[model samples]
Target: MRPQRLSDVVGQQHLVGPGKIIARMVAAKLLSSMILYGPPGTGKTSIASAIAGSTKYAFRKLNAATDSKKDLQIVAEEAKMSGTVILLLDEIHRLDKTKQDFLLPHLESGRIILIGATTENPYININPAIRSRTQIFEVKPLTLTDIETALERALTDPERGLGKLPIKLDDDAKRFMADATNGDLRSALNGLELAAQSTPPAEDGTIHITQAIAEECFQRKAIAGDKNGDAHYDVISAFQKSIRGSDTDAALHYLAQLVAAGDLPIICRRLMVIAYEDVGLANPPAASRTVQAVQAAQQLGLPEGRIPLANAVIELCLSPKSNSAMVAMDAALTDVNAGHNGAVPDHLKDAHYAGAKKLGHGNDYKYPHNFPNDWVKQDYLPAGLKGSEYYQPKMNGRFETQLAEQYHRLRKANQ
Candidate 1:
């Protein structure tokens, strides 16, 4: 049975609760085209149906993957005849440009209230034109309490639920189903219905659902992760941040999530980037070790691959964090982009070219190798950027501390 009203929606109270966006829109009788995005079985379609039922508007359902242009034509015709209609389009990310072009005018004219639903991120998967015209809302996964409440309603409601069936669900069974579905109400309800229908009633004329029966119905809850969706980027971002923050446990947790999702290649690549971007200078050896670990993970592959990945993650997390290198590069790039095209000094220009001495190339250039410590005070930057100090090393670790000391000493000697 579908939700008949907004209050009947299981979760996402942020959008459907009193004084929420959907409730405010319904109260004002002003609806706009919107896209509902989230993992599957998260009440996107249910919310759309509930809105249509409550508003008493003509409602039509179509699948973007299977429906043709003729289906949209029919909906457009009906909306014109009825003055308004709400169309619930599923898998909206799959809608081609042709269908988007067809729906644009209707959406703009306020004749068809479009409720587009997808399990993909709209910003990444949808056409800009379509995304710009619609407000996007994220429907979150249902909590265990919400799933349990829905199951109870289905078992007792007379009109559209299994009220006539004498199904007696034990407390353990109810909790098992709620927890086994992993926040998916649809899976919980379907499993409950299956157990109720197939189980033989006892001598007391009661169909008892036990923990074993519930497990049989729903084997394992699938982890919600889409490699091409927002979840992938979100996990990767969390992983990097954890490492940068020096939180070893948090970094390992996100690493395990990616490992469980079987995205080893992405994990390896992200680890390498984090080594240089977040762990640079402070621990240069960490960068080298990270590169080697990634190579090892790639060669070993899977179960065995996770070991090397874990080794790299722990090393990076515990290593001193530094963004000085990243900042230095960005500062230099900013000057280049700002048209700071100062000519190179003759002494610093390419001197190996033929007849270079005639142009004064390499003239008066101090050879660092010829001096004490194999170093000399020299101008390497362009003429306009003289005296610019970009590499400011942070003294967070022993290596960087030594480097910073040497840098200050050299600057004092040059002065």
Candidate 2:
């Protein structure tokens, strides 16, 4: 069901409620081109419809990817006749240069108040011309209470909702519908409608919708909508944090959540980052395997991909954790960033070029491979910043333990 006024919008009170941006625009009658971005079924269209209805303007809709320029001409004609028309352009990110050029003048002259809707980051995907003309707004996912309010309204509203049907929705069933959609109001409503229509009326002439029926109508469990949306990021953050915390079970739980969402690219990317950032030098072999597992996962798509991904996740969680490499790098980077650097020692400078020996470059340099144990103690740091120590190896794993021993030994010899 679509809202006829901005006040009727179920969620996004931040934008549509009293004193909000869109509401202020409608109240002041200062309509301008705008873009609404979020996951599907979050009232982008409803908000556009409500704005048009509230302002007494004609409402039109067309998909930028599928509709032709002829379709836009029809809306422009209507806008000319009616003075103003609110056009809801779906997949506005896909609007080509041709369509954009045709609509630019109408937007400039205030003939058409374009309400562009997309699931993509409009700033990155939309052409600069379109973005310049439109004020971008993000429609957030409906909260549990917000979805419940919409559900209740849909049950009793006779004009645009399934009011005539005598249906009994259990409390648990209602919650199932809300949570299963992950803040998608449209899917929840559709699933509810499916349950009500498919189930035959009971002996008392009332159709009962239970949680089990709701699940059946959903068919698959919640596949998170909008990979860039907040909920998806929350799950991903939890996934990486669990692995870093060495909680294998919790890590797998989050992994399963992401796998169900089917964002393989993000899964592979985050896993590789965790391998080096969280489980570095302490378990180099495990980190290396993590990289290989991600490669294998990429080769084999989902279902099979999940196998290698799972192995990588388990190994990373159980491996001895160390961030010493990351810490060391950060320490060095900090010095460089803060202007704690100086000119390289002449001995360390290249002497291959002509006249380099006259500049004293490499004149005192001693090759480390020619010395005992392929090592030599020398002043590697510049004179102004002498004896700088960056690496502090952790004795968390066998490899790093041996590395720490050699590193300290070299330090002692230099001293």
Candidate 3:
């Protein structure tokens, strides 16, 4: 049967469930720009389609990976005129920066209710401006139970369903199907359909799913809808975990997998960010080194880039690890998110610009150079966070130990 309604959606109740954010938005007819993010076959496109089918608004679809900038401009023009377009941009991360910029003004003006879809992390892959304007909801893979329910529905439903299939799915067979799919619902259903069509019928007119047959079916299974699909997240997770577990070899292996599979440069850049975030100051060198490595790769291109990348990976794995910087950054972000924004202290404001000094910029600013060792204790943070420690160094290596020593000396002298 056509999966026409939310009730028909096999999984992702987390998004479509009663009183959930999307469901609430739908019920209230309060649609906003949104991005549905998840791995392939988790129904990103299907969900958009369902929303379009159910809502009163106009729906437009385009694959950013293949669509030209001109095509996108036309869609934006249409959206501007209509002002009711639910523009579903599939593979939105593939759009070049210029193509992305084309949509920014339209999004800002509320001409289109953008429903972007991506198998990649939107925060990492999407243009920051477009992403900022949209609400993101992750659609999770279907559970085995959900897959089984989908199978049953497929077998029983009339239209768009597996019709008149005389098949007996033994426990082993069903387990094989579910396990093979790795929570991909479309895969499970397609596999079931293949088994029904190919397996010969017995005297009872029912097909038996034996282990031998299952293996053969799996080997010959048609390429799933997503060729370069679910593997993206799986590989990235492996790379991050390997680095976390301090397995340089494994981390490099995953990196090679992505590079071999044609992952985007920005994806690598994001992982470098994680290198700083998860493996910061403990290995203060990691972030900077990773940044340099990415630049090298970009400049050298492919085969040659692998060398610098390998070196960077080795450095990161061996370097002492700490997440203190990440902790501090996150805490600072929390303050900003909570509207704890404080204006730059007058003394900290720039004085070189015209009329800046007239506005008291840098007025009464202490000349620390005149102090002993060109060092002096002073308030650096905003008023509310003054003297509030953010970077608490973990004493493990040269950088952190030096930082800790400085903090200790500063604290004692100030006291």
Estimate every model's Cα lDDT from 0 to 1: 0.87, 0.89, 0.74
Which candidate should be chosen as best, given TM-score against the real structure? 2
Query: Which has the better lDDT: candidate 2, or candidate 3?
Result: 2
Candidate 1 ranges beyond 4 A from true positions: 221-415
Colliding pairs, model 1:
none
Clashes of each: 0, 0, 0
Lowest lDDT sum, 10 consecutive residues, model 3, at: 220-229
RMSD of each: 12.9, 10.1, 8.8
| Number of the predicted model whose lDDT against the real structure is largest | 2
Report model 1's TM-score to 2 decimal places: 0.60
Q: Sort every candidate by TM-score, greatest first.
A: 2, 1, 3
List of clashing residue pairs for candidate 2: none
Instruction: Please provide, for model 1 over 87-154, each residue's C-alpha lDDT reduced to its tens digit, 9 standing for 90 to 100.
Output: 99999999998888999999999999999999999999988998999989999888878988999999
Q: How many Å off is the CA of 127 in candidate 1?
A: 0.9
Please provide, for model 3 over 155-233, each residue's C-alpha lDDT reduced to its tens digit, 9 standing for 90 to 100: 7666677656666776556655654566777777777888878989999988776644654676622112222334445
